[model samples]
Target: MTQKIEFIDLKAQYRALKDAIDARIHKVLNHGQYIMGPEVRELEERLEDYTGAKHCITVASGTEALLISLMALGIGPGDEVITTPFTFVATAEVIVLLGAVPVFVDIEPDTCNIDASKIEAAITPKTKAIMPVSLYGQPADMDEINAIAERYGLPVIEDAAQSFGATYKGKKSCNLSTIGCTSFFPSKPLGCYGDGGAIFTTDDVLAKACREIRVHGQKRRYYHTRIGVGGRMDTLQCAIVLAKLERFDWEIEQRMKLGARYNQLLDKHGYQRVKQRNDRTSVFAQYTVFVENRDAIAKQLNEQGIPTAVHYPVPLNRQPAYKDICHGTVTAVAERVAKQVMSLPMGPDLAESDQQRIVAALSEAVKIGGF
Candidate 1:
């Protein structure tokens, strides 16, 4: 009998770190400071130390992190933020919410990340920032993007929602740009039990602005300075993250190893996957592959007790809501890949035996359907 596999085995992770997590939660319960408790600062300091960034501001969610970062920069209507079209909607949604246009650029076919070469051409006088999503837990060509931003005097905000714990050129993903934002959504690599996120920046001035923007633009308890949002991650969530952090490094290591193992297995079976650059390490937030007849394949996998998912099926430029707002330039690569990408079960707790079974089942499914 084949063992059942979980797409992301959060239960396994919880089991592995239950004691610490429970203690942290109990500590929070005893204090009764759910909103911005001491654990909030403690988590921030731990994250800052982990990423080597000068500051880390905990926020309500990854979406809020982006919005607050943009607000801190004073990005309002008519400003253009250049970014990839092939990521989660929140990447573009945050820009649109601020009344800024997300200038959609095509992604690289192999990695599904914003093509750094294509980014320079998208810049205009109205371009305020370059927001790059680290799709599938891999950082984009941040160095190249940063160089272009420097030439144009623009800030780079890395939408690292999927790439936390990943390293780019020996530097962590969230610290690769002017402002780095990450999600702690339950499914993310370093997720909390609920919505949580953090902003990373080496710039003190920008850091100050982000901190103020998260709490109704307050420098003091009741003082309001600039326009802001009520975007504060609760104490419970912070405590959960702190507990998870205790084993984060080891989990990231497991993800890397599993990703490599997946690569080897898939390659042996003549399957193609999203490419990882040599200079960077992806946390494999979602281990994905290129496949056709996604619906048929997914159905087959479901029947076999294997599960699959599509990271995205439509590019933002093609979505009805965004088609009108984003510049009408066609992102051919994004459009093509969106139709072909499919995610396999992935997590730090994935067992090697389960991984082999998943690959074998996938290989069999692909061959039988000729997809």
Candidate 2:
């Protein structure tokens, strides 16, 4: 009998680090400083050093990180943020929640990242910032995007929710642009046990603003300086992340090795996947591949006990909530890719035998599904 395949295999990871995680959690429990505790600051410092950023502010979630970054930059009503329509709704959701507009752009078909070349044309007088997502653990064209932002005097926020451990041109993902925001959701490349996120920035003013914004916009206790939300990451969650950080480097290395192996295997089987660029390193957060008859293939795979998922089935611009706002915007690439992308089982602890079995199942499924 074939062993069951796990999509993310977080349980295996937990087992590998159970002792450390338990100790960290127990320490937090004993201290009773559940909010804004010492572990929170310690984690922040470690992340700041890891990413080479001037400051790191822990937040309640990835969405909160984006909101706080936008709030710190004074992005609000009547403003516009240019971003791809291919990413998770959170990227655009934060902009809309601020009563701002999200200008939808197309993606690069091969990489599924925002097409940086088209960004300049999307800029308008009302455009406040450019938010580019590092989709599927790969960085967007940051150098090119940053150059365009500089030309228009706009700030660039890297939505690095899936690309935490990735690198772009030798710099870490969350330290690549003006303000970088990343998620620590349990499924992400560098995840905690629960919802968590962080914002990285080099600017002193922006960093100070983000720190305040994460705590109800208060510069000090009970002294509100600006409008904000309750977005602080819990102390226990921070401790969990700190414990996980101990093996993060090793995990990233394994991801790279496995991603390369997957690429080679898929190529041999005549399967197509998201292409990783040479200048940057992707952590392969989802290990997604492009396929025809995605629904049918997924169904066939599931019957064989192989897990599969779709990172996104619809482009944000085509979604009901955003369609009217971004009316007439053409994202042909995003629309086409949405129908073809399917994520496979991926994790640091994935065994070679499991990977081979997954590919074998996929090969059979593709043939049976007539893809």
TM-score of each: 0.98, 0.99
List, residue by residue over 1-371, the lDDT tens digit for candidate 1: 54568899999999999999999999999999999899999999999999999999999999999999998888999999999899999998989998999999899999999999988888888999999999999999999999999999999999999999999999998999899999999999999998999999999999999999999999898999888899999999999999999999999999999999999999887787999999999999999999888888888787887888898999998888999999736799899888899999999999998898898888888986655
For candidate 2, lDDT tens digit of each residue in 253-350? 99999999999999987788999999999999989999999989999888878889998999999899988776227899999999999999999999
Those runs of model 1 whose alpha carbons end farther than 4 Å from true positions after fitting are 1-3
In model 2, how large is the Cα lDDT of residue 274? Answer: 96
Over 4 Å off in model 2, which ranges? none
Candidate 2, 110: how far from true, in Å? Answer: 0.4
RMSD per candidate (Å) reads 1.0, 0.9
